[model samples]
Target chain A: MTATLTAPPARGDERLARQSAFSRLAGRPEIGALVGAVVIFILFFVVAPPFREAPSIATVLYQSSLYGIPAVGVALLMIGGEFDLSAGVAVISSSLVASMTAYQLSVNVWVGVLVSLVVALAIGLLNGYLLVRTKLPSFLVTLATFFMLTGLNLALTKLISGGVATKDISDIDGFASAQAIFAQSFDVGGVSLRITLLWWIVFVAIATWVLLKTHLGNWIFAVGGADASARAVGVPVKKVKIGLFMTVSFLCWFTGMHILFSFNTVQSGQGPGNEFLYIIAAVVGGCLLTGGYGSAVGAAIGAFIFGMTEQGIVLAGWEADWFKFFLGAMLLGATLLNVYVRRRAETRK
Target chain B: MSLVQLTGVGKNYGNITALSGIDLEVGESEVTCVLGDNGAGKSTLIKIIAGLHQHSSGTYEVNGREVHFNSPREALDEGIATVYQDLAVVPLMPVWRNFFLGQEKRKGLGMDSAFMRKTAKQELLDMGIDLRDVEQPIGTLSGGERQCVAISRAVYFGAKVLILDEPTAALGVKQSGVVLRYILQARERGLGVIFITHNPHHAFPVGDRFLLLKRGRSLGYYRKDEISRDELTALMAGGAELEELSHELDRGGGGVAAAAAKMLEQESKELGITPGSTP
Candidate 1:
């Protein structure tokens, strides 16, 4: 017979302890990043008078918007237990395709964006398919995708621009329309901010909601943590993993379209530097390289810190190269702190 | 009627034979104890029954109907659940979450958090897991508690037949008693239970039928009414081998007579040393 087996509810010091422990463990990643960002903020403002201006903050948000949106998607993919090395090249490829279609082939901006997304999706599907079907390490599979896309991006640009760095699409039929939507800027409190900043907030919100509130979220955690166990329990592991890869690619392509429309041109090496940045943001946000745990909001915070330092270093009259050094130190420190706190939370005494 | 029956089952792993020509039947509202030494095909048999591995040959029937399961899910879908020694549960999750890991209830495409928490509490309460807090990660619970949670989960998911793989091996005597009580509870609920263990003492009292295994082959199957505890234990340990061991461990300057007297005393104690015994 079915009997109601009830355990007493957690109360008193136990509940407090659990909450404190969780906050300490889960909060460390963001807290570390935030602290570092504040330190950088103070150092730059004190040393460089120009950094104190509200416009400087707008520039930071604008830069953060471009990198932040893709980082959120990358974080989810990482947490779900896979890699996407081709994500950077995917952005470049999508940007080029969007520009070529809307500016060169005289297609509608929306349609060009859609076509670009489809191409990216196909690449993601192929990557997910090969990795799962062949049982290859995802790192190797995505690395192959990265090299292939890199070659494609370079070859396509050279062919289209006749060995030039990029193709100009100022006179294309959809250029005006794309520019109207993506290139627009608004002044908030006397600070000019790109609309991409708004996009970043929306992206983070949606990504957060999906990570915490959906079945897909559970599968992502399960697949990344222990795929075999997840499969044993009847979770659709392959489908979830493939879906995550596709979402990552979709985000890359979406960001690429935004960049292409904002600048009205696309280059061969438009996104090569982005791969490391996405991973760094994810790692700093507390995503384990081994997978199964992370937060979209934390990744967004990591990007925010990156943006602050990217602009702050230059404004502080430091050589831009120092920014990389700062990032390295910040990443190492944040990663160690996150890993330590997470271990404490997961272990039972 | 039998809940599950394996007819002339055999299994081979590449060059190594894991099981050979085994026949077993489990009846409803009864316990079938499978006792074996290590590498004696105990685990292999469990895997076969749980649908983790298919038998190389033989027919497995549930409720008198032959069934083939391609995966564990298929087996579970047929109201058969397996609770392994380590227990398949995520320790870092709440007890309720572990209860409904892959089978969560959602409303309008989103997780109904309120409902999950409420039901998780109710279900645990229903199953008699008196936890200090359901919100605590399952890792904090004792091994016995965790095993109880797994058993309760199996029952909640509509299990008609439950297979426990070495469920008491990792537990202390007290903890083992708790699990045994739960097994009795399950049996009382009219569910057929398969208890697998190396400990014959634990198996003998609860089992309606005893199947002893050695070297991946069935030694024999005995109904509880037909065999005494000593006979079952002797057979399980390979009576001859155990006597050889007892002689070696005896190491007595007190002679064979003294050794014989000591062994008789030990045996009687094990088998509930009766009153007014004559040597």
Candidate 2:
């Protein structure tokens, strides 16, 4: 029983060398986003004089950090093949919970923050549990959650405070330290940088490591690419998906706390439209809506582009209404660019 | 002792019997080929052995000890791994990532990227697979290359019994030959290989034992020495029924059917079995 014939190698060294280094670089998902970011930067630097100032640069980074935090989470969740439509309202709900609980009960602000964290995690857990148990689309499940949280944020805020906003918590015990940790800004090189910027960098770094270097990261790609195939190979698909949802909620809670302490008050209607911003940033960063292909660093760059574009328009003395149109154009452009890059990469090989 | 043994194993889904009275054995370092046509209980048998399904009757023994597996994970824990036709590799992921998909090596709080890359490359090389770049996405590989990767991954992960579901079924002649070589390599490394296919030409080359299955029941199990390739093909294609179909076609029509019937008679004569013989 020794009639087996070995197959000749399909490729040779000459053919392998034919793949130029530049083509390989062009295949990366982040390359398009990176190029877009640089082009946007150069356009703003030349046209918007105020944007060239160091303090203005810091402000843009600060704004980017605010969106960057949740965008990083959204990028991971998107790569894992799901979305959290409630992410935006969930942030407001968290801040409202923290402000109202601390103001009404007169408890230390730290306790309110802890309670908000728990609530955020629970919402995430519910979203994941329902998505897995009912086998419904995450978009629908999170959409339902989005509406519910929006209603609750208003109703609960008004019910607790007589107005559609939480009472100011600036005078509350532990307010000073909470504000320092969440909202304080520091000066560096004659420019002020928000603490949120530091946190944003940390989030991006950790997420990039997880997506590229760990077993869970592999499982995320596997499950997102094909859940049935991943399960067949013994990857814990359900746990990975649930964990991604929870990660997104945890970031939402963190961002929500910053919003609460930065302003010392939270308006119930503040979070409804922000979820779209986070999704846009992730998509711009090269994460596919279909999942299993993306980078966290790309999401951060996407946020930076958003921040620059929004501020650049103001600096250029353009109407604020034009910002929405620019965002729409960028989203469409980035998605098309990403699709082309992916096709080129896959087909060339 | 046999690495895997099934005695009187059977399965039923309410009223439909998928498999029954299946007696099979696979010894270490031997390739036991399971031959069958479509809907001949091949999938059901693979599922049962791979722990995707439980046997409804009789016993399944591993190393002389009766055991039941509730999931593929459990079967993997027992050193039984099934490489499905789809290969279970994420197409967009790199070769090293797909090779260690569910089971990845870690260093500190992060994955050991350097170690995983080196080991995956070395393992493929050890299996005589020359991959130009392990960083390339698994989807870039041809069908034969992908099958070889799957086999090498199973071997590296300490799979004592490897169940391959149609590894060469979706490949060309040269690609199929490549997979047959890998199957022999796995057998040489002392793993019990269950090679399932419908092609006797593919099976007879490396198979030490042959189990022919037809419509949920075992037609018969024959050792390599007990069965010729012609006998195996005839049995798999329907021995007496095929002969009867040829005679019916010879009388009924001309052109394609008549030509096919004449070819069937020639094959039967070469096998020393007359076309009309019942048994």
Candidate 3:
């Protein structure tokens, strides 16, 4: 009726137009986060002279890596349409497990690290299994897990070691090697960089490849976008969700090992509310809270913005108390920018 | 031989009879339309054929061989594909991604984006849908174009029998017409196409054979030559029972009921059915 009731053209539909290369780049999911990052960086550059130094930039990167590593997992989970509240405490839980196991049994720290990996993954599996079997929202399930991990981290640590923190394991066998792999720093051009900085870049690159160049990546988006449609098309919705939950666990374990080896001690109460930081980074980087439209690079950039805000204030001679307020402001600003850019991209052409 | 044939098919849910005594035959290059209202066992029939459910009684033959499908995967393995309305493609993904969604071409450990992109564009072009860019998200396409993508994907995957469950059930006038065109396109490719819809106007134009169903039983099955469009409408609208309702309303004296009765009366007249006159 709309096409004059004539026969459809055997070629070229008029409703679609080939967008220009520059316009397509502007339409990418990370564009908003990139813009936000640049704005924050330039803001700090103008206000703080020390922020321009190479060493100071290295410090900012090191801080961002800490948040970025977990943000990777959080970004993937959010894209798959779930989030983990237990992630912050879960990292501490891993470190506690490793430190206590090595101190109590007098085994090598590597043995403790391996055991922590298993425990971390189990926690993730539980979160996934409960979600799939009960069909409850991931919010409630992970919130409950967050509280439970917090309690277990404290009570179990107290019960085993009689203190809120575990004994230092720097003197344990394999401590030096484990520290080298997980917490050691390398110097480049008179600037020292943590190994996690390298890991963060590598992980982000791998995630980007999987998302754009692999079938599993497509399934992840499909499952998050419309799981019922994914199921109808024969995609394994349950396995993908469960696997995502486990992936968060695996990354948390890596993050936990860094803490244990670097500090040589485990503080059970240290990481209570850090989950929000990871989530904030993901959201600021342009991950939709509802899932299905996000990128890991956006999340990494979000973490960088976070690191810059927290450290930039200190360098600018501002009170550290203003960090939370600034972070909240950036998150709101970035999310609005993302929504605006997304609509423009879709409406263009 | 028919690509799909169901003889005396029936489905019973414990004591409830969801569908019964249903017979359908779809052959190569033919469009078979299943017409029904809500709760008319249309979905049950689609399910049985799609392998989501099995018939409690009767034989389901594929190429003259009796077969029962335990799941959609099994049905798909036998070259039977069902495209559900509103659940065909992932919206956020690009058109090419949705086209090769579950069936991506793998290059060692990764999807061959180069090969798949070229093939998806070529495949859509072959079906006469020249999209501007395969990189754009599939959700940007109109409702009708999305359905066409699903239909073309089924054809490309070697689906010998394509079962569409209300492809135009949620579309607008022009969009529905667009989908109707693609229905003919699938039939032209020599696939047995089963089109299900509640609108007779949508079905009668392209349907080679019409199966009018009500409640859980078949009202009648007729080839295009055996049933005229008016007869098909009357049959789909409850044939003799509709004539009784028209008279009952006509006998309700006056007021709002009289106005509604007048509309129903004129509708029956347009279709050449004299209300209260059909025996």
Candidate 4:
């Protein structure tokens, strides 16, 4: 039977306008982080005299750039509603492999980096496959990978360095070439910033584009949101989940190689506890643990906040040990705030 | 020729027989009604035809061609579409998106966003559903609206034989009325409709033939012109015994309640309500 009530001609436009208004008013986490970043910067500038300097701000962004690259990958995975605790440990594992292969094995840097990436991707794929197949919690699977890779990092480093903390790649054939590309700095407004900041920006742009503008990005949200519904409608749930896991792993390797090439030295203890930090950045950036909803740029801004605070605290003449306490406090506060923000946005509709 | 045929079909879960010795047929452009009580193999018949379950014995045919379907995808490929009570529509998604879910249009190396929305709107409007906003979440629509959207989706996908398990089972009078209209519309559009419902009244008006089932065995199949609605309802409710039971209830509880009960019996008798008629 035909419905007696027909929709108005302007109905589609009205609904779209309403949705856009809701999104604008709800303020996605990334936008919140941008606002928070300004607040944090203003607070630090007012409290610490040196923080107002262009050189000091550039230093914070330069340092933030390093952690920011890994955070972008972490955020994408988190948005898909999975975790990779192994990422932190993988950093050192991948860096050590790349450095040792290049300096110790006398291989080319690119070849060494490729080997490291292959290993990381393998771990990620195995972890994702097991998680999807068994339907087990990701925390346990990635935790196991974290410890296993952590052990491998130490064992391999010791095998090559003979009990040393780090291996010197200073005289390696490609050391200068690698350093020029990864570690080189340029003067901008009398403040020298590492080239890694540019890498961080590119990562943020690409990650944001994929999450918002592409079909793969849509699947990422659906896979994390309600997998059963996604599968019922014929979305390839398992394949998408596995692919996201591998993306996280590959990104971790990429960031690790960036560090190795920048420093011309590799240490065994490089990335051990950094996984938690990356997760913290993502959380502060407005990602939900429950999956299905999050922002990639929010996570980048989250990394920026951490980067600023880490260097900002020192600029304010505070003891570095207190940085942990500050980070813990911010993560808890941001999570609580994110929960409130998300609940309001969802319920408003 | 039969569009779908099931002969000696049976299904078992461990030791429990969900269906047994089922013989059925659905012809092109004709509505076939399959009636049975709960646990009398109604679900089993639908599942086997829907490709959700396979038959353990006998053969299933489409267009007089014997075939086996291993999955629902295979069934759809052969033009047999099953619409369940739940409808499989994502509530949060827009109507247009849900309509073309797995079969979305693509353009310039990506999903053709404009084309999908435009075609979905046109399809619904053609079905007499005047949706002002195709972008509103499908969940916001009433139950009748949801079923209409689903029926339109099935019809648009080129289903040659549509099997509705219990379309009106969960609906109110007005809502069921809406669905019945859509079924008749589909029939007029030339697709064979398998109207599986216990309600003979719902089937009597539209069905071309009726298959009376009791305890997993077919009582008989009768052409619509040969059987009256009262006789079909009587056969469906186990005939004269139920009429005697209804008459007995009125005399024993004769009061204000008896008056209401008598009124209900009169309505039931006049409308020829059957097992599938009640909620």
TM-score of each: 0.86, 0.93, 0.95, 0.79
Ranking by lDDT: 2, 3, 1, 4
- Candidate 2 error regions (>4 Å): A1-25, B240-279
* Pairs with steric clashes in candidate 3: none
True contacts kept of each: 0.24, 0.51, 0.51, 0.18
Index of the highest-TM-score prediction: 3
C-alpha local distance difference test of each model: 0.78, 0.88, 0.88, 0.78
A15-123, model 2: which lDDT tens digit per residue? Answer: 3676588877677778877899899899989998998999889989999999999999999999998989999999998999999889899999999999999999999
Stretches off by above 4 angstroms in model 1 are: A1-31, A43-45, A101-106, A180-183, B12-17, B170-178, B227-233, B238-279
Instruction: List residue ranges in candidate 4 displaced over 4 A.
Output: A1-31, A164-166, A173-184, A319-349, B13-16, B27-47, B50-53, B81-100, B127-157, B161-279
lDDT of 1 by residue, B105-216 (tens): 7778677766776776666665565554556566667787778888878888889999999889999998887788888888888888999999988898889998888888
Candidate 2 C-alpha lDDT tens digits along B25-67: 9999999999999999999999999999999998999999998
Locate the minimum summed-lDDT window of 10 residues in model 2 chain B. B270-279
Q: Model 4 residue A138 lDDT?
A: 90
Clashing pairs in 4: A7-B132, B198-B276, B199-B276
Residue B138: error of model 3 in Å? 0.9
Clashes of 4: 3
Alpha carbon lDDT of residue A287, candidate 3? 81
